[model samples]
Target chain A: MKPSSPLGARFRTAVLTLSLAVVATLGSVSRADVPVREEPQRPSAFGATEDAPLPTVAPGDLQGLLRNCDAERERAVAAQKLCEQDKTGVDFLGAAYAALWIILMAFFALVAIRQRRLSAELATLRERLARLGER
Target chain B: MSASSPDADLQPARPGVTWMPYVVAAALLVALFLVFFVAPRERTMGEVQRIFYFHVASAFAALIGWVGCAVASLAYLFLSARQGMEVIAKITDRLAHALGEIGVLFGTIVLITGPLWAKPVWKTYWTWEPRLVLMMLTQFLFIGYLVLRAYAKKDVAGRKLAAGIAVIGGPAVYLIHVAVELWGGNHPQVVSGQGGGLQHPDMQLTFAVAIASVLLFAASLVHLRMRHHAFTDELEDAYLELSDREDARS
Candidate 1:
């Protein structure tokens, strides 16, 4: 059987490349169709009138506020210690991702090794057949 | 034909390009970077939500492989039934087997990652959720097909039986997809329904890239596996011919 002319081969390659480009463009366009939904803003922690000017504090009131701050800091420290005791140090996210990549890489390595072994076996088989033929 | 038959060497085995594997490897590496670095972290789930990228992408790839296996199995069965194991039928058989194996590999990844993601979010390693159950069933069904292919005798009858199993197993994928809708479950509908799908554009972009990369990787695996299968078939044929010549000499 005769092979195709060089002109025909070039034309086929051109058509194949064009088709691939068109398909890629269409895929990207289709994926981009899903619009991202924007989230609504929540009110500030200071309340709705967060921009209002602060009222002047009495000297006596300031002293009380400082005492409250000291007590709150001591309580917060105790709460943090309790929380830390319950918290597990293991990072599940990192572990999950690591497990996934390990599985994939192992499979890839297995295939590569299998291919190499098969090629080597094939070479050995060919040599044995050649020796048999010589006899 | 005998071992010394000229036609054995006359058949051309097309040489595969050297660069295709490198291209796939690079694409997958880029996808990994995009998944970890580029995609926006979910507000509620935080860092653990990153698992969703590859988990969903692998599910997509596995589904594609199973569906491809079903189609190829049908083609092989139809062609072999009519034409008695012709080249096209044999090629389809090889494709079906390769796709089934690749699908199982990806499916195993899905099952493993599901539990890893679930343990932190759901406070348990496993659940009897509808989608989970259905996905498990689907994985088991195809796995049964693989077991049959591996353990069964190397003959047309074995191939036919395995092909039939693949045909029956293909619809399990559809059932798994609809299982969540059919029964109320704990599984999050991130890709469908109202309210809480992907909110960030970067998440969407990363998901797309991940899916494309996984699909490209799957295609490369199937191609390489098919080539391996073809070479094995050729080697087996050559061995049989040589054995026949030895017997004739004896």
Candidate 2:
């Protein structure tokens, strides 16, 4: 079948392209394991610095560090601070609400515009029919 | 207008000029109040879990819209070919189209809001889980229906074909409803046959309110859309009438 109009054909093509883009993006991102959240402002306690010198640790000292877990406890304390500092969850929540409101309002506006246009078109058609009937 | 003219049955009814809008507005406000202030923060996800109230509610509303579209489309298909049933057939046709459009709208909300909620909770915006895939498929189907309705010829055959699309897309909704149970995806099964997803009383109450409000709002949208369809049909009929008169005079 033919397209209703040139504009309709263009609109359909655009919609199809956008849908494909969305599907491709989703497919590519679904495989990613990394969390989408941004890292906290404070640097993490863990991860070796490229410029830092590696200290040679004695076996006894290594064993003591492993058994006492002093470094692990400090990392945990730092992790708690990092978790508290990160506001990604709250930001996402706000974004979700905003998206919802935006979509709903846009739909309402679309309906309003369609109604106004249709009313005007209908009145025009009826007036033309009245003029024809009078002759 | 003569009884035989297409415009004879095209009188516009102002469905939106009713109490439905006030009720929907009040219900939405109450639901928002319940979701934010009354519902307690979840232990694990904290405040972000609040999105669950509307996310799930939108899914419910979308399903209703799709299922209702299917039913209306079936009626239109059955009635369109019968004699002297043109008015009822037109009504069903308009209803089907309205529901189909509304389904797409709500399904879009589900798709958008789902990812937003998932980004932090699942640590990803989207996953190829069974339920998620099914929901996405449903959205595509309804979107196709709307596109077809918009571009197809304004004739009985075109309407029937559009109705067929809706009818075929109907079963996908049921499959989406059961996808979590069948495939055990990352998507949570909040309301199920076994029942136990929502544990808190406040959560359950907020969810109920949200579902009611969203569903009411969707139904009102469908009603308003049907009125628009009627006006469009009336305009077409007027054009036809004017064209016929001009031909006679010439």
- In order, the TM-score of chain B in each prediction is 0.91, 0.93
lDDT of each residue in B130-239, candidate 2, tens digit only: 88888887787777777777766365565777789899988988899888678767666557636546666777788889999999999898988988887777676667
* Candidate 1 local lDDT, A37-80, one digit each (tens): 23322111101111223345567798767766776676567556
Best by DockQ: 2
Categorize the docking of model 2. Answer: incorrect
- What does fnat come to for each candidate? 0.17, 0.26
CAPRI docking class of candidate 1? incorrect
Native-referenced DockQ of model 1: 0.09
TM-score of 2: 0.79
Q: Taking the tens digit of each residue's C-alpha lDDT, what string does model 1 give over B161-242?
A: 7899899877888877877778866677777655556666777788888899889888988887887778767766776777
> Candidate 1: which stretches are off by over 4 Å?
A1-90, B1-15, B193-196
Error of model 1, residue B23, in angstroms: 2.1
